[model samples]
Target: MSHPIHALYANLSARADRPALSDGDTVVTHGELIALVERAAADLAARGLGPRDRIGLCAANSWRHVVAYLAILRAGAVWTPLNPRNGPSLNGEFQRRAGLSLTLHDAASVGSLGSTARPLPLEAWLDGLADGVPPPIHDDPAAPFALKFTGGSTGVPKGVVQSQASGAAALASLSAFYDFTADDVNLAVAPLTHGSSHYILPVLAAGGAHVLLPTPDRAAILSELKSRVSVTFLPPTLIALLMAEADFAPADFPRLRHVTYSAAPMSPARIEQAIARFGPVLSTLYGQTEAPMTVTGLSPAEMTDPALRASVGRLFPGTPVAVLTASGVAGHGEGEVLVGGDLARTEYLDAPELTAASRHEGWLKTGDLGRLDKDGLLTLIGRSKDLIITGGYNVYPAEVEAALTAHPAVREACAFALPDEVWGERLEAAVAVDAPFADDAALKAFVRDAIGPVRTPKRLHLMPALPRNPVGKVVRGDVRDLLYPVDPQPLEALR
Candidate 1:
C-alpha cells in the first residue's frame, strides 16, 4: 500500500459491518464496499489494464460511481469522471482526447461513445468479474490520480491533472473543515463529477454513511432531511430553491448539523432568509477544481452574523492563501488570489505554455481579483477579466452586483464592459428580477444611490433569469451578449 487509497483501505476493516453507501433501495456495508473495490480492481487488471492507465467513468450519482472510483484508484489507475448528462458525443470526444483504454458507464449515461474506449456496462462489468484481492500498487505521491475537468465557462475545457498528494491534502482539509465523524450521515445532491463527490469521501474515511440522490428533487431532499441526515452540500442556486419551496420551521431540520453551499456567490438577502429558515446550519466554501472542498469555508458559526455573510470565509488552517497585487506582494489588501500548498494543481493535462503563465513559482494563480479585509476574510471582487473600465475608473462587477441584488425585486445581476470612444470602455448591467421595477430610470437611480455614479452601467438589460454555467456561477459574457449582438470591441483599437 503506497497510495492514499491504501491508507483508507487499511482503515476500512475496523468499520466493516457499518453501512458505507446507500442508493434509495439498498445499503452497501463497509465490508461489501471493500470487497467490491478489491474485486473490481482485480477484474479490471485481468481485462488488460495496468497501473497509471486512464479509465473514464460516465454515470449518474449512485453506489456504482463511488465503488468504481475507489476501485480505479486502488488498482492504481487514473479515474476520469465525466458528467453523465453531457450526452454521448461530448463524453465520447473527451474520452478520445484523453486517450482512454476502457470506460465503465451506467445505463443512464451509456451514450454513443463511438470508438474511443471499450465500453463496459457498469453492472455487467461488476457481475462478470471474479472476486479477488486488489492488486498491489506503488504509485508516486506526486503522480496524477485523477483528471478532473474544468467548468469551461469562458473557453475550451481542459483536463486538470490532480496528483495523489493533492487529493490526500483535499481529504485532510475536508475532514478538518467539516469536523466530520463516524456518526455523520452525509446527503449528497449535486453531480458527483463536481464538488459534491469530493465532499462525501471524508465521511467514508471517518466510517460514516453516504446517501446518493439520483436527482436533486425538492420533495425528496426535504423527505431525506426528516430522517437522520447529519450533513449535506448544495450549491447556492439549489439552496435558494430549497428555501423558497420547503417549510423550514426551527425544528424542521434539527437532524442536520451542517448544510454547506458553494460553487457560486450567494446573496446576503438569501442568506438572511436561509439563516432564518434553517437556523444557521447553512455554510459556504470557496473552492476551485485545482484545490477543492476546503480553500475557505464560511462556517455555520461564522454565518450566525449576517455582517460576515458577504465575506467568502477565512482560509483553512494549513493552506497558503495570499492576495497578490500588481506589485506582487503577498500582503496586498486587494489583488489576485495566489494559492500555494500541496493541494494546488501545478499544471493542466497538456497545456504547458498556459500552465507556465498561470503559475508563479509553484503557486497556482487563481485569476480572481479580491481583497482580504483587516479581519483576514477574503472577499471576492470579481474575476480580473470581468473588470469594467468606465471614465478612467475601475469597477468590479461583484460590487455593482451586490448593489443590484440588494434591492428586494432583483434576484441576480451581472455587469460587463463594451468599448466606448469617450470612456475607453463603458459599463452595462443585466439583472434577473423577481418583480418588475418602476422603470429603467428608477433602477438606474437605485444603483446610483447604492453603489455610486461612476460604477453605474450606461445601459441596463433586464431579463427573467441570468444564464449560468453548470456549477451555478452566472456567466458575465452571456450578459454582455444580451446587450450587444456583435463584438463590443473597437475595430483594431480596444486591444
Candidate 2:
C-alpha cells in the first residue's frame, strides 16, 4: 500500500502548476512541493534514516517546515515536530526521548542548540536535496508515524504516539466531514507541532492548497480572508481578539467557508458573536493530545442554535464515545466521557504506566469531566483533575470560573483548590481584571452576588496575566503558586 505522503505527491504531480503551499510571496507549486519532498527524502536516506526512524523537526510554520515534514514521511521516518519556541532543552529532551538521530531546524534554532548537537539548517538541507531523486515510500501502516506533545493542565508536556493508520484515519475523517476539495485553501495559523495545526496534511491529502501563515497577525489573517482563502483554523483566544479589534469588519471574510476553533473552550458569548458576524461558519472541536481529533464537535448550524450553545456537538465519524459511571460502563446519558476509535493513540512515549492508566482496553479515558446529554451532545463540565474536594464536597473549578467570568467586571478567571487549615482544601480564584478593584473585599462581594456563598472564592488574587503553555493552555501549577505564596503558617496537627 502507498503511504500517505505518496497520495499527497500524486496530487502534486497531477497538478504541478497549481499552488500547493504559500507563505507570503514564497509559493511552492504542487510539482515544486513534490520535488522538495523527494530531495529531502533522498538526503535523509543518505544520513542513514530509513523506515520508522525518528526525525526531529524544530521550526515555525513556513514553506521549509512543510517540505521538511513531507520529506521525513517520504523517507519513511516518523516526524517529531517540536515548538520552535520550546527552546533547546526541549529539543534535546525530545531527541533523547524519541531516539532522534538527526534534526532539521531553522538557522536561529540551530544556533541556539549549540555545537554539541549540530542540527541541519532547513535552507541548507533543502538546497542539498533539491536535485536528488525521490525516494520510494516505505512507511509501515501499523508503525508509529508522529509524536505530538501536548502540555497537561500541570504544564508538563507529554508525547502522544500516533501510528500511520491513526493519522491517515483522522485526515480521512476531516476530509469527509469538511467536504474538502482540491480548490479549498486551508490556512495554517496555529503552531504546526500541534495536531490541530497538522490539518495541513489532510488539506494537502485532499488536493487543497495549504496557506502557511507564519505569524498570527490579526490584520494579516483578515487580509488573507479577504483574498482567496476559504478555510481557516484559529484558537478561541485569537478569535476573541479578532472580534474585539475595531479594524476587523464582518465583510472582511467574504470567501471564508469554515472557521474552526480547538485547544480550549470558546465562550458561548463569543460563539454567538462569531455566528452573528460570520454567518454560522464557526466550528468547535474538543479533544486532547492523547487522542487529538477523536471527541465531539459543534457544527456551524449548531452555533446558531441557542439550546446547543453549550454542546460540543456529536462524535466524529468512525469514533465511539461512551459515558462511564461507578456502577460499570453505561450508555451515553451522563458519565465520564471515554473515546474508542482508530484515531485514538495507543500509548505515550516512554510512559508505560501513564499509557496503561489512560488507555483502558480500547477506550482512552479523556480525563475531561463531561456528560452526553439526552440528545447525545457532549457537554464538558470540567477536567477530572481540576475537580476540587472542599470540606467533603466536590467543586468543579470550570463551573466556578465560568460563574465568576459571567460577572461584568471580570475579564477572565481560573479557580483551583488551595490548602486551608479549616476546610482541608479551599476554593481559590485568580482573576484577570479589566480594571483595578478597590480591594479583595469588593471582588469577593461581587463574586458572592454572582455565585452565592458556597461557590464564592475563599480568596481572589489579582493578576495582570496568566502563565500559559505554547498552545494557550493555562498552567495550573503556576497559577496555584501565584495564589499561595511560599511562606505560610504550618497547618494544625492532624490529631
lDDT of 2 by residue, 1-495 (tens): 535665675455557878889988988888878777787788888888878787888877888988898888888888888776666676567677777777788875664352224367888877665366656777667788787776656556777787876777666667766778788998888877775455766777667888887778888777787788888888877877777664555577777888988776665556767777766688877777666664677777777787777667787867778877777566566657888876675578889898889865678888877778656688887777776777777778877876766555565678877667777777888887667887878778766886677778888888766667655777766787765667254322321
Model 1 scores a TM of: 0.94
Tens digits of lDDT, candidate 1, 373-449? 76669888888766677787888888988888777677778887788889888788888887776688888888899
In the predicted model 2, the residue pairs found to clash are: none
Clashes of each: 0, 0
- What are the lDDT figures for the candidates, one per model? 0.79, 0.74
Best by lDDT: 1
| Model 1 RMSD in angstroms | 2.2
Predicted model with the maximum TM-score: 1
Candidate 1 Cα outliers beyond 4 Å, as residue runs = 112-115, 373-375, 470-472, 488-493
Worst 10 residues of 2 by lDDT: 486-495
